[model samples]
Target: MSRTEATGIRTVLSERLLQFAADRALQTREFERRVAALPADSPARASMGATLSAAKAWEAGLLWVAWRLQPRSRIGA
Candidate 1:
């Protein structure tokens, strides 16, 4: 593949990853809202909170990978 083609594909993949990460963040927020409604000391609340932490971590990793996939500017372009 040509350089242009490779760059285009990377751009598309990066955009999709960003979109996915945004969607995941929204879902995580909703989960947090629901979890907050549960009694603070409820076992289910604790369990779901743990799951929420995992979701947040996954989202962060996705964002990091997407950022890495983005095209970098040339120093003297």
Candidate 2:
């Protein structure tokens, strides 16, 4: 691939990854808020906890993908 094309691809992928990370952060915050408002004895709290953990794992996977896509050095330097 040409240097220009490779740089463009990396830029696009990085931007998309940033957006995905931000969205996941918002979702996690909202989930925590909902879980906290639940009573101590509420059965739903347990399920929400599991969901939060899964969301975190998903985010970590996305980060790994982003790391792999990033340019290791100046693309054309």
Top TM-score hit: 1
Which runs in model 1 stand beyond 4 Å of their true positions?
none
Provide the lowest-lDDT 10-residue window in model 2.
Answer: 66-75
Error of 1 at 76 (Å): 3.6
Question: What is residue 16's positional error in candidate 2, in angstroms?
Answer: 0.7
Tens digits of per-residue lDDT, candidate 1, 2-42, equal: 98898898899999999999999998999899999988789
Residue 75 lDDT in candidate 1: 96
lDDT for every model? 0.93, 0.85
TM-score of each candidate? 0.94, 0.82
The stretch of ten residues in a row with the least summed lDDT in candidate 1 is 38-47
